[model samples]
Target: MYDSLWKALKKLPLLPRRLNYAKAPALRFLDLPEDIVYEIVHHLDIRSLCNLSLTCRQLYLSLLIPHLHQQKLPDPFREIHLNGDNCTAAIPALRLLLYDSPIKAFTWRAGHDPRTLVREVEQLRRLIARMSAIEYLELDFSNNWPANEFRHGHENGYWAWVRLATNLLHVVAQRCRVVVVTNHYQVLVPWVTFIGGVPYNLDPPLLARMCAEWRASAGEAEALGSTKLMKSPSKISLSHPDNAPASATFPQPFPPEKGSTVYATRRLIVNDPGLFQRSLFGEWALDWVSNMPLTHLVIHQGRMRLPLLRQLRLPRLTSLVISHG
Candidate 1:
């Protein structure tokens, strides 16, 4: 009878002895080892990090390694944008201002004369100081800033802006450099170059000063040269100016440089020459010129000839493209 029972058991479908032995034993779930669990947890992102934090005591404790979960949530905590008026506003994340919310980009939008915009750029300067990593930056006033000023008062808003931008550039650049040391993050930051202008043109003198100061901030080998400058787009007017005829200014034949950020203009519209100027080369371009040095020149979309202004003189322009639709 014993021999018959053994033969029947052998015929049954059963796992191999080694496999049975390797099966998870009782109480194994409660005693999950740290390394295995941590590796599993490492696969999750910021949201999962928060979820695991709420899972249980063991999970919460293991995920607390500041090194593992310091990065941001997959969904951005804030939505920062440049408004129609060119004001910089960080939405919904004000509480994390000094913490998770670091400034990524800044702009001194067009408004007053050069002297005035320089003054107004003060408030913006303070904001740029906090961002450690800036992906896209806008320095708004690259066109027609008013020129003329007095040494005047220390409190004069004018003195504050240019000086403030200069100082802030140093601070922001240091912050960016630090981030580079820790992570190999390939980021695209649109460093805008500009000063504000409402009534007057851009202040070229102040912009150069700002650039000089920013380049001065870096040590040898760390300093960014002039190659960072993004080019301007072709002049596209949706509506022809009655005062400035289609024959007023012909399209210049120039294409954007290899890395030019401003390209692929979908629709062309012209409301005001001033507006077009700002839209093309205002604060965003100027700010880049200030914070980072720009060596190369890129001329955006251009045509061999437009029925506008004649004679194009852009000798320094290296890249050229002519498109007609």
Candidate 2:
């Protein structure tokens, strides 16, 4: 009977043997050991790291591991300039700023490509939306010079750039506490015109209309007692001599009892005394500085203008600095 059974089993084809060992669990991104994960993170830039953090909760937590802090990894994108040469990098920098870090101050210059101008302005608006407040903002749109004037053949083409800049300034000025520094005279002309400090007959009628609308909005904000719109700076340092504006006449200061205004600034630093001159840029800055309730005044690396210095009425003055040129 046993021989008969063995013969029957052999006739039935031999079955494959099943391994006794268990199958290994699938390897996952999050399942990687902590040190290996950190080693991968150390190789990533800020933009890449930000992207990785968005994948899953486990990976997000892994990025925040204390091992990173102990490692002291340097972030290369901390301060980025979206100027002409590096304009292509703006998108990545914008992503970094919008997602990873919030800069207190920002400076952007216009690129030669009119095609990207609208997109750049939109990106800036989006970035501004992400911030609660800005300390300082500078907009430089002077790159579209005579060489590129023909690129914008129609009068209306230029209006888009001007309007975008004006609108952004108004939006940011409401949340900015420090200063909106527009260094280029071409860009400054429109702002000065909006303030009625100077008359610039802009060729584009749309820009003029926009300026009028801006004036109305500013007046409305002031009338509505929107004091939180822009507060005076606590401390101001004017260091760039090259940014001083062309010379202009100045109106006599109003008597203190009549129409003098005081600002919240306690410290005033003028690294270049040339900024105190009677130029549109200098006067605009000094006009604001003259009203500061300063406790400290510092002048460095230039000949001090005693006459200009005398104009500052610092009732709370305690520290004065007049360093050698």
Query: Of the candidates shown, which would achieve the greatest lDDT relative to the real structure?
Result: 2
RMSD, each candidate, Å? 21.5, 16.5
Residues forming the 10-long window of minimal summed lDDT in candidate 1: 181-190
Encode model 2's per-residue lDDT on 102-154: one tens digit a residue: 33445566666645756676676656555544433445554444434434432
Clashes of 2: 0
Residue runs of model 2 more than 4 Å from their true location after superposition: 1-21, 25-50, 56-104, 111-115, 144-146, 149-163, 181-325
Candidate 1 local lDDT, 263-289, one digit each (tens)? 211111111122212322223323333
Clashes of each: 47, 0
Q: TM-scores of all models? A: 0.27, 0.38
Residue 275 lDDT (model 2)? 45
